[model samples]
Target: MFPTSRIPLMGGLSKMSSSLMANVVHTPSILNSRSTYILERARPLPRIYPRQRKRPYMNRSTYVYKVVQQPYDRLMRQQDLQVILVQYVEGLGKAGDIVTVNPNYAYNNLLLPKLAIYASPENLANASLYKKSAEEEAYSSKTSKTLMRLLPYHTIPVVLNQDNEWTIEPWHIKASARKVGIHVLNEASIQIPGPPIRGPDQSLHGKDFIAIFKVNNKETIKMRCKIFIWATKPAERNSIENQFWCFKGEPVHPEEKDDLDLLPIEQFNPDKIIIPSGDLENTIVCAS
Candidate 1:
């Protein structure tokens, strides 16, 4: 007595129920346990870390220090430097920059600080001394140069007479001057010409001459003179012996005698002599 619609409801219901159970219960125990373990391990640990203690920076003072108060004395005692202590009204009191005494300490704490001003006694003393010395040296150098330029000539001439009475003639006086550095330039002696001669028959005849002196090949100054000797016999122009030599008598080599290159011979004439204003004390005569 089986029913006409009997298509095995039990089998179909059992398959449907099994499919529903498979779809509804999807949680995996192994996967869930692994995720739970990872989460537990990832949680922050409460570990103890020791705190590091930082060393405090030592504060330094800004002040200059030296072995002795007097910089010059201290410097003298030292082997190297020679210091001069000088006083200055300006910059009396200032602070010295803080400097490091040790390099092993942290550089931030050990290096010099920018809080210092110029306060070193040595530095101030050096500045003052240098200033004074510089001024004095400048003034002295200027004066020396001026004096050197002013004194162009140094020697004068004095004539010798028969009785040795010195008679300084204008020509001799003018020719006496010598340049300051080396020998006199363009030096010439004016010759004293012998007076006119009376002929054997007692006729009036004269020969007046001018002495010509030359430096190297160039002619220097000339001396005009007339001398009266036996019957007014004229003498050849040779009066340099009578003229005083400006230089002290020294035996000089012939080659060295002409080595002094001086001004030309034509410059000593009276026409070109122009005395500067208030410079008569330093008058220079020329060569002719």
Candidate 2:
């Protein structure tokens, strides 16, 4: 009953849809003909999650540095600098002495300051005749390297005035050190790394405090110093026996255990003195 032209139009529509259905039925076979990787972007992606965070810089257990060591000769050629002192460079070397130093230090501090010169044949020849300057002459005698060797073993005693509100000062220590033949000429070089000892605190008495001393400009030396409050009263004064300036651990105050005596109050005895801790004696030994 339809017109011939309209019939062909309907048939064409049905034929096209049937072709689409056929292709759908064969979809797996068609896809198999093409590469599987094409559908998957490239290949199967790795098993990493969508977003991963990194550990904090400070919290990281591993560092990303590698050490590469070179030959000693190579390092000496590059990093080390040979110099001759035109003037004395304290802590480095004296004039006329050929010395090796850091390249940067040789350039900036020595060469730039005119304190030193490069080691040349002509300069090396003349270096031996150079005498130490006046300042160097004076200083060398005062602060000797011997002091560094001696100071570590001995505890320098600094006596402070009792009943005075004075805090420990460097000058008070310098005076005490000089008497013991330790040449601490400059008070500026001394530093107390401990808390201030103000007034006459009995708890602080006979306690060894650490003091740091700067040697030259480059080296540091540490010494132990015991601060003792000068006893103004006779009974409270340091006993003439058993302990000289300080007791073994703590001082037994006369009020606490004078005659009640749990601690020994042994009398001073200077023998031919084969004892382990013999009494300190003034002996006349004639060394012929």
Write one digit per residue (lDDT tens) for candidate 1, span 75-150.
3222322122122211221122122222332123222332222325655444443344433332232233333333
TM-score of 2: 0.39
Best by TM-score: 2
Winning candidate number (lDDT): 2
Q: What would the per-residue lDDT of candidate 2 be over residues 1-81, giving only the tens digit for each residue?
A: 222332222212344454445433333233323222211222333344557575334423243333343223343234678
Candidate 2 error regions (>4 Å): 1-144, 240-288
Query: Total clashing residue pairs per candidate?
Result: 9, 0
> Which pairs clash inside model 1?
190-223, 193-225, 193-227, 195-227, 196-206, 220-288, 221-288, 268-286, 268-287
Q: What 10-residue stretch in candidate 1 is worst by lDDT?
A: 88-97
Indicate the worst ten consecutive residues by lDDT in candidate 2: 279-288
Question: Which runs in model 1 stand beyond 4 Å of their true positions?
Answer: 1-128, 131-142, 153-155, 158-259, 263-266, 269-288
Cα error, residue 8 of model 1, in Å, equals 99
